[model samples]
Target: MKFGYRIIFIVSVVIFFLNCAYYYPFFSDDSLISLRYTQRFIEGKGLNWNDGHPVEGYSNLFWILCTAILGKSGLDLIWAARILGLACSVGTIAVILNCFRKLHVKKEYVFFATLLFVTTPCISVWAIGGLEQPLYGFLLTLVLTEVLYIITSKSFRRIYLLSVWLGLLALTRPDGFLFTIITAGFLLFTYRQTKTNLLTITLAVVCIPTLFLLSQLAFRYTYYGELVPNTALVKVKITFHHILHGAFYTLSSFLGTFVLSFLGLYSLFILVIRKKDLFGFYLLLNIAAWISYITLVGGDIFPAYRHYYVVLIFFIFSIILGLKLNLPNWVHNKLQAGIAILIVINVFLQYNIPQNHRAVEERWEFKGMNLGSTLKNTFPDKTLIAVTAAGCIPYASELPTVDMMGLNDYYIPRHPPANFGTGILAHELGDADYVMTRNPDIVIFDVGNTPSFYIGEQLKKNKTFTKNFIKVTASDRDADYILFFNTYGNSTGIKRTDSELTIPGYLFRNNEDNAVLFTKKKLLKKMSINNRYEIILNDIPSKNWKIKNVLGKNLEVDTEIYQKNGQLTIIMIPKKELLLESLVLEGKD
Candidate 1:
């Protein structure tokens, strides 16, 4: 039996590794946010989001530190992050298996539970997401297992290990402090029964984690000049409106798949009632606190139940326990078969539930990367660009960017709109006037597309912005990139000029004098037929001008010239794609 169980465990681990390998290539956009910071730090820029501007935009401190250390060894930062995440994923699995073994869970039960955990998409997919969640999950599991061990064995010998893990967990994410508090409260509540040294236990449970928290706070204050991350200021809000949205986020993530959601909640309810099992009771409290905290903060923006990953193992363990306790003897005999069926159903749902959503994120990330590279090649290095999707575009472009949504900005988060929480979470903060003051050479709304957020709308209404910035289209074979370009900025490629062909009593202000000066320089994108150019020449007696298509005979173009009342009007009908050197009108006097 022992040999068979050993084989099962080894096989389960292999399957879990394969699951991670399958999802390893799909990179999350938000994960790039951390990598960008890592890249800057490795370049000796410190924790500054942009150059010389320190803002605690990222929530993962230790994850960035670990990745930066790997990066210092000349590893690619993206791969560094992914490799660290893979290590953490394996560590989490090993810790859980060890915990189960120490608890003396039945070999058959452990095998089934391990199968359920390894098959869940949330675990496998998120493990390779290049974010801190995998590390967070690993530390959380170690801490939870230690708590369970202490509760079951009635021994405080390894309590110090719990303290160290708790401290590390808190460093992984800001909300990790919640678990520290919960563990401390539980220890204090059960102090007298254990007859342990109260002061010693307090030092291990409370002091160690508090010291970790304090040190981070000191670093944050010293480096960024703030105690809390700017992200918390922008995103975290405690209100009835946010709680409702968070509840919806939570419900949608769970109810999006009925069987899995039902199993988790039902198992948790059963586990809560088993008061004799102190581990189950403690888990219930932790989950409740977590739910409330996530609810208050308006939930997460990323799909695949990002915020719920830390407690995923607890839910899986409870489901296994619930199945064992609630089912009849006949069903218990086929527990392994039942769990194997559940795993199959879950794999099917995983494709639709999170995998589809992940595909959408990947598409946007790729688009941002393409757009950023184009902008980098087209624009001057000093040319500043503003954007709403603050991750891939800015990182790929390596440009100084103004985060329109204020995730990495210093000004906007401090001055949000009055009715902030009523709109989309974290997207409610924007100051059009403030952004205009920066005078960005190129302003990209919704990540190089159209305007979709508050700042974009605000900028559209500003008269100064409308007068100064001209909306232009730069098209290539792949797609059309739209952005607002400053009309009067230095380093000129396109400029508005009066028609050299003159006629009396006629002004050539075609489309508010928005004319392109074909300078023969390679623009960001090829000029498509969508571009229009009209010029009216004044004081011209007759239509003596002949239109010339400089582009070779392969591409067709239609040009019209009309003369009325000694005024010559020329219109370049964009019938085909043209380069900057396509049109040249010569006079035949």
Candidate 2:
């Protein structure tokens, strides 16, 4: 038994480490949101998205503190986040491994359960994804373990200790308060079993979490003038549209991992039949409540079922107990070998699954990192920028930012649309007029240099936005950048000449109302492989204008024009370079 335990523990650690390594360089952009807060907090800027402006954009308070401490020690906050997350994940494994032993689960079952826990791609992906999930997982698992010990031993001595862990759990994530409430309810539900010290037990279980909740609430109201984080306001809308989307999101996650989902659900069903079991009952409430809460919030936008990881931890113990309770005599005897085979299959499937959110995020991070570096180099430190990706670009640039999505904005959430929950989760709140009033020097619609969010779409139609900002492309040897520049704002002596029209990558002329765009044929061909470019000419004269495609017959070119909201938009598909002289727009009176 000792040898088997050691082997499984060592092997699981190695496998988890390797799994995290496989996901290297794939940091969650959202994680950087917390780290940015950490950076500000460490620099004495007061947990703010913009300096002197206090808004609790991050939900992970404990997470921010952990990284902030390390950042204060002069460590890179990004690395600090990654290391802390991974360590907490390893701690969770250690807790669960010790838990399996305490429950006296068989050696084979231990191997199966530990392997399943460690091999699940979601677990390891989040461990290094640089968010608070792993820390939340560790705290949650520790709390559950303590509860299991007390329930099995029928002891209330360590229940007070459990309260402190529960408090920490609540601080790790806003939704963690749900767990504390459930645990408090569990204690109350089992009151008859502990009739000796009712008042003491009640105080221990209830007062600690209540205090923590009150303290947090008081701090929020005092500092940011809100009872909850700004993120909650942006994300936690209770509309039918959001609920329906959340339902689909939760269903797809379960269906994606059908085998594991089946086992977890089956385990819960078995627990339901055993009406007298206290621990199993507790597990059922936690799982059901969490699933319901996740559904209510419109699920998560990130890939890899992150919101479900805590439930995954609970599923482990429940499934192990179910196997012991319900398997037939023969099946129980052969369960070890059968599960070993399943573990092998699972290892291959989880690591090699075609789920490629990591790849997509990696590309986005690369683009954001470069754009941020360019912005940092190009503009003054005080230049205010507005961005939809309130993560990588802002963190890297370290400039004042208008969080276009309201995740960190003070005004947008308070002034949300009447039908706020009808759009994308966390992206439904924005005021184009409010953002433009800030006079942001640069406005990035998305990380990938394209208009991709509700805010960007709204700004595109704003006449003030169209008249004051121009689409500018700047290129460094390291990266090509595209963003909207506010021409009405301070240019710092950077002049736009109609004769040269130089902006690193391309050249264009904005002379009077006759505009001409020029790009090297090679560059255009490289950028537009589909042989197309969409150009919107804003603030055009209200005259019948014709855009002539004069690139010559050496190659075919097509031009289509649409006039809307005083803007003439053209879709040009050219087989070669767009010559400045060839792109003449002549207006007929």
True lDDT of residue 401, candidate 2: 90
Q: What lDDT tens digits, residue by residue, belong to model 2 across residues 220-286?
A: 9999887878888899889899899989878876765555667777887887675445778999999
| lDDT for model 1 | 0.72
485 in model 1: Cα distance from truth in Å?
1.5
User: What is every candidate's alpha-carbon RMSD to the true fold?
Assistant: 6.3, 7.6
Per-candidate TM vs. native?
0.84, 0.83
Runs off by more than 4 Å, candidate 1: 1-6, 21-24, 193-195, 257-261, 320-332, 354-361, 490-521, 524-578, 581-589
Between which residue pairs do clashes occur in model 1? 502-538, 503-537, 503-538, 503-539, 503-540, 504-538, 504-539
lDDT of 1 by residue, 1-589 (tens): 2435457667877988887776656667777778789889889888877886688889999999999999999998778888898788878777777777666666666676677667766777677777899899898888888887787787789989999999998898998999999988887787655445577679998999999999999999988888879889889878788999899877766654445556767877876775345667777888889888888898877757777776576675676566556656666567667767877887777667763357334556767777787767756777688888888888788888888898899989989888888778888888889988887877887656777778878988887677667665555446666667664444322222333232110111235323232122335213346455555444554536665334432245566777788866666545675433334455554
Report how far residue 349 has shifted in candidate 2, in Å.
Answer: 4.1
